[model samples]
Target: MTSIDASKLKLPLQMLLMGSATKLVAPKTKTVFIEDLPPEEVAKHAPEPAGLVNLGNTCYLNSVVQCMRSIPQLRSGLRAYVPPPRSANSLAAGTASSSPLLLSSLRDLFESLDRTTNAVPPSNFVMATKIAFPQFAQTGPRGQPMQQDAEEFYSNLLTVAGGEMRGNCLTAGLTGGQSAASAPTPEELDGAENLADALFGMKMEETLTCDEFSSAETAAAASSDAMDIDNNTALVEPPVTSYDLHRKLVCNIQGGSDASAQVNVNHLSEGIALSLSGKITKHSEILNRDAVWTRTQRIARLPPVIVVQFGRFYWKATPDSQDHAGVKCKVMKPVAFNGTFDVYEFCNEKNSKGLEEVERCSSSGGRRPYRQKAQGRR
Candidate 1:
């Protein structure tokens, strides 16, 4: 065989490489359509709300986003976000670019939900979020999509959104909206102390009292001198200091029934308030006491938004098997709730008294019937 010259083969090699590159970089195309309708017709018959396209097992994120969008205030505030500058050499500056990308993508996704007539995929938002938080960018061992806890996702989103809000507030103050004194510091942002106070904060006062018990020697001496001592004599310890904090109220479900139970949100709130008020036998490490009765009461205030989490899952011991010894099963009991209800009964005495008249009138005959609102089901 005749050997080809090296220079003669150079052009063919370059052409081959170019061809491979073209195949690797081919563009993907997607087609989208919108129905044509007159402005009046569109206004009269608004299109159904769009559903989110799940990316992998991202239904958890979609559920949270949908719920957040339902709140007009939060949706509007997020839409009005202004990203901070990324010029500083600090660690915060390093993350500024990625954070803004996630925020902007989220805003865009929300805007699309409002404008689009059909289901919209949040591909850009999901990708940007995954880039910002690498821990969430995980795949299953078998190459299937991984699942995430909805509560954890909600908490992370809140923290990120809170940071952005703090940044925006600081930028506004520096740009002449307010003085630097009014600007929130990084510590405040990290804990979201200010936002928590403004949105879901409540004031609670807790009281603790120590139970009196006679020592063994004192008890024996008292018994010996029982005839000489007065029967009305007794010793008492001072009450413990009252503790106060800004905290959110939590409602816990006590029991589950096989038959479907009608759950009233207001009733659940009342149960929490009542359960928190009673005394509990608690050991005090600081006071070196074996037993102490502690009581918690809601002195005043309630959050603008109340978060209720139903205890619907529990761990149950199953018969020992080869595959597993126990399993965590979800409660299948149906819980019915109304779209809106008054929670005045659960509030403190002062607050409940104020709402009694109004609530009584609105809830005449001890029953307030509510019409079911249409909701999109997955």
Candidate 2:
């Protein structure tokens, strides 16, 4: 390759460089080599008079510092950036010098990178120089982290502040002998009719997907008056919201706790829950035997749990008591019933000695023992 000899050629700005360097005007130079000046070394030799590095030296060294700081991560990544060997490699690639703004722009680039990216010197130094920085331009809405930050910020806020209610469930408190309506439980707010859910951080969804809308199909059935009216006598009680229900006494019977627990649904909503003990009877004895016969009389009889769930669902409560239907919303949670008894053939009862199979009485809403399959419920 053809080459120019540095020894014989006159360099530009030679006299102004004014540094200790071998200069000459000879021919047949043996070699040409690049001597890199470290940024620190250049800074050390900047001409004191110009208030800038030596114009020639300054350009080279300024190029080094400019290349070092141009990385957004480098300057603000730490209290002070120290370029690592990997960062210095960028200078060898000569990327920063292409732009005239390189030196003036580097320090400012570090200022607005994510604040979490900033740290103390040694740790920040490696992260800033060795890794590429994320684009954190604050120029437009798309460039900002508004969506991610708002979600994270609200999540943190909920953790600190309490009193968020979800659905009909309650984390309510028990108190003294005050009527449940106005009882002052801790964290209790007044009538739900008076409050808004958005105030509780329940942000509105802009659109409901098809599946979300379909979930409301069952909810519509639940929000009706069918369960409350007494024409159908059954034990299923209405469901409740946290606001309308309150604890009056502690009766810890089932759970081995003297903890008195019962939910009063005086102002019962569309939801209701009830427990009652009764005998469940099917209309025909033939239907029971036929169902059993069709199934090949499985195990000589039905496994008793099936019979009990059927009994509980079908039990006819005494019509005098109010039938409080559970809230139709999410009320489909199967009603809780303690089935601690086995089914008995109605004729096999010890309470009836020599009882007739069918006892008939006059039609004044009186008792006529019909041939019926009954499940004794409690």
Candidate 3:
């Protein structure tokens, strides 16, 4: 190689050589100090609501979950839920049930939806639902997931949620220094501690009266042969009153003899009233024979939230059909409902009085309603 002294070279040549040398080396990246940079004008945007992506034919699951998510109280309650502590004895015994896993999966799903605006794929939730409910795990002939009924799924989901809520309350009570001996019964806990029941349960009173038993003794005795009643059947038998707690109220869409008439809010109300109070023909032990039993139901305790499921699907007589000559059809009636639903008419005396008091306070601007007063930071 020919030895060249760069120091002996001309200034212009040296400058040219230096420029070429600089070109050969990598250029330094521009340093940007966060503080030195101009104040960033980040476009502030409100968080848009996140949605669930359908995992297979899982729109039923998505719809039901979204409906539950719409309830802020339920969401917050589930977030605060603490899973029951697994006993060493139980763990050593065998694998645990998948029931509690549904609640955890649901909580995680809600958290994920809350944290991001992106569409969340509910694969875990779908799997959890399948494990929790076998009915939801039904598949089509091609092995693809089937489209299940949303209403049925909703009921099942609530049932699972209620179970989880009970467990949560039980765990909380135990952890808070409460002993098993002093702990409240399941029925007591339902009204007091179970979050699901507190939100959606309705304590119903059903009074079943035997029509034949209400008649005069002479008339009853005369009609005894016709009704197949025993001659010694009591005429003044007391009405049988029973109580039950229901999570949802079903409203029949089709009512009365008119099938073509459009069902409105008034019709819906009538259907609910009928459901609450209906007549059934059955064998009555009090009458000692088959008779018409009139069942009247009243709401003893009303929940803060009420779910009214419209009975849309029904079996229609189809003479042309080969299978059982009947086909399942959906009533696509446009049900008109008001935003404000007054359940005072359906409430019992005590609940009605409480509602009246609430209305009176609300109208006078004296105090908040019972529901509002009971609401906490959550």
Which one is best on lDDT? 3
lDDT of 1 by residue, 103-129 (tens): 788878888876655677999988987
For model 3, how does the per-residue alpha-carbon lDDT over 1-378 read when each residue is reduced to its tens digit?
999897887776523333443446555887765445432211113234577898888988887787777676676667657777877887789666666788788889887776555689998888988988888999899999888888888788877667777654544433343444664465544454566776778898888887665766844564545555555654455688888888867776663244544444345566677568778887765445677889888888766677777777766777886778877777765555544555667777877888778878676765333332121110
Backbone clash total for model 1 is 0
In the predicted model 3, the residue pairs found to clash are: none
Tens-digit per-residue lDDT, 1-378, candidate 2: 899677887656344555656686567865632235544344435442112132211232222332333322223222232222334666778643222122123333333222122221222321232132222111245542221222222232223222222212121211122234543333333322111111221111111111111233433433243334333333222221111111111111221112322332221110111221112222212111211110000011111012111111112234465665332121112323322321222212321222222223354453343223222221
lDDT of each: 0.56, 0.25, 0.68
Q: How accurate locally is residue 266 in candidate 1, as Cα lDDT from 0 to 100?
A: 35
Best first by lDDT, ranked: 3, 1, 2
Model 1 CA lDDT for position 344 = 54
Off by over 4 Å in 2: 1-149, 161-237, 243-378
Candidate 3 global lDDT: 0.68
Q: In TM-score terms, which candidate is top? A: 3
TM-score (all chains, Cα) for each model: 0.60, 0.12, 0.70
In terms of lDDT, the poorest run of 10 residues in model 2 is 290-299
